[model samples]
Target: MPSPLRLHPDRLLPAEPGLRAIARELYAAVRELPILSPHGHVPAQLLVDDEPFRDPAALFVTPDHYVTRLLHADGVSLADLGVGRGPLTEPAARAVWRVLCERWPLFRGTPVRFWLDTELADIFGVTERPSAQNADALYDRVAERLAGADYRPRALFERFGIAFLATTDDPADDLAAHAALASDPTWTARVAPTFRPDRYLEPDRADWCKAVDHLGEVAGIETGDYAGYIAALEARRRYFVEHGAVSADHGHDDAVAEPLDARDAERIYRSAYAGQVTAAEALAFRRHMVVEMARMSCDDGLVMTLHPGSSRNHHAPSFHAYGPDTGSDIPRRTEYTTALRPLLERYGTHPGLHLVLFTLDETVWSRELAPLAGFYPSVYVGAPWWFLDAPDAITRFREAVTETAGFSRTSGFVDDTRAFCSIPARHDMARRLDAAYLARLVGEHRLDLDEALETAVDLVDGQPRRVFRL
Candidate 1:
């Protein structure tokens, strides 16, 4: 017989009896609160269409880079896992499932294991631990569940208790699906698009000119000149706001946002448009656009979120084969203090601007990020993001930022997932971890039990809504 699989009721709780009890109490109070995912890669079309998901591998093993990256590291081929392939047949997909099950031991204590185990047991009702022996059976069971009405994407969205969902979208996107969902009387859930302008900022890229031309066509502003380009971006921001978006997201190479002189900016824009820009000129132009984005936020009331310091596509071969977000991206050391001074000096205190800064670099959390959030009314520290969204890192984030910025000044936990089913699992883990952290505070007498409980609830419900302006 297969070993029975079950999730511990207090899996992430503190070990001490007193602290465990307090954590359990705190968790119970906010365990079922609605999830507010303010920044994520989940496509708006998925929820809008309400289509049944494809297969087990397509749904779970393939789309999630978190799972694929690790498995690839263990000598699994990306093509075998359906990474770059169009779609996997049921048999082909089951082969991938077998790989995951056979190597279950490899994921012994990883967060991916935690999430998959939770999803299998809680969502799909898998009663046995997956192994090479039971991989086919587990795959069949999950496939059956997915074909059911309750397991459909919209049903799962509702079942997951998502109060507000934000999807990252290019500035040129029309948000047709978002509009469709908003007008559908049957769909009452709030789904909003977040304006993402990373492509427009990188003039050194091969497709930069084409993207600029596309933006001009969509926004009805000429891109041949710097003034018209700025107008086009501003127009898109307003369009997003009209469609219920409340935030603009930026993922740049760094956090620098210094402004260039108008003459220099115009010269560079003309050169970049002509496809003759140098690497240094491209970096300077991108940095300058960051400040311009801040200015746009101040004018339009859209929250500005900065995700910086990801060295994307570290492995050239894999990136070439699988394309970006195939999990080859790596993080490098990043300094925020000197890099953000230009932007901060200009709009750091602007009453209308809300700048939430995120980093893969944890070194700056206490030293730079916290202090910046504490000082500026507009600056808020983004939650532990990308590689730092694990249990230990989440705890460290709280410890690092709380003393300087406090709870209110920090953006709450965002799931930032593309796996539709993992939404609840991710949010639940965060809630449990937050409860445990608060329980420790209460136990230490640093915070009262009642206050800790209240704060725990706020972190789940109030914080995201307030921080993202939902």
Candidate 2:
């Protein structure tokens, strides 16, 4: 007989029964709340086209680097797993599933295991444990369901209880898709874009000059000089605002920011354009641009989000084959105190600006991020992100920062996912973990149960919406 399938009644609850009950109650209150996904990489066209998802692999596996990377690490080839290659035929899907199921033991204690199990059992109603023998059957069942109308992107978005979803877009992007979705009266989904300008600003990026030229074309401004480049960026910011973008996103290897005079900035820009800048020059230019971007945000009234410490595209071969965001990116240690001093010193007191910071470096939670956010009028701490987007990390973040920065200083949970179906699962995990933590606080008499319940609700839904201005 097949082994029985079961899910923990209090999956992330405390070990004790009474506290588990409290956590369960708190989770129940916020579990059904609408998700406010202010930062994510889901394609805007999915919401624009309002089309049905093709299949299970397309929906669950192909776009998720977390799933694919784990499978890759376990000796499964990306091609055989139907990643970075082509569509998986039914037989190929079964093979991939069989391999994954046999290696399910690899994910035994991982958060990915929780997410996959939740997606399998809750989303697809698959009661059987995934294993080599049952893998093909489960794949067939999920594929059948995915072909149905109920599994379409828009329907699933509604079913997932996502009230707001924001997709990242380059500043040079025309955002015509966003415009199309906005004009469609039947589309009730509140989909918007976030401004991301890394390619145009970073001098070391391949085709930096080409990206700047594209920016000029989109913004209808000349890109012959530093002043014109700034003008082009400003124009794009205005266009992004018109198209319902409330936030601008920055992804950097470091949190470094610099203050430079016009002469020095212009000279650096010239070198950047000619591809003659040294590594130090490139970093300084990028740092100065952060300050420039912040000053622009103050005028444009767009929230600024900085995600630092990612050494993006760590694997050159995989990147060349599959392109960016294929799960090869790695995180490095980051410093915010000194790195962000120049930018903060200039705009730290700007009440009109909203600057949200995220780091993969957990070391900074108490030492740097919490203090900076606590002191700066414009600063707010982003959720525990990327490698740290797990239950333990979330709890640690609350514990580390709550005493100094407090709950209000941090932006509440944003799914920050490219996986659409995982949005609810991620949010559910966050809610359960947060509730469990708060229950512990109440148990210890550090916080009242009533206040904890209220705060739980705010953390789940209200805080993110308000912080990102959703």
Best by TM-score: 1
- The TM-score, computed over Cα atoms with residue i paired to residue i, of candidate 1 is 0.99
Question: TM-score per candidate, in order?
Answer: 0.99, 0.97
Return the number of clashes found in candidate 1: 0
lDDT of candidate 2 at residue 230, scale 0 to 100: 98
> In model 2, where do residues sit more than 4 Å from their true spots?
none
Local accuracy by lDDT, each model: 0.91, 0.86
lDDT tens per residue, model 1, 39-67: 99899899877788888888888999999
Q: Which stretches of candidate 1 lie over 4 Å from their true place?
A: none
Candidate 1, residue 337: the lDDT equals 86
Model 2, 107-136: lDDT tens digits are: 877778888888888878888887777877
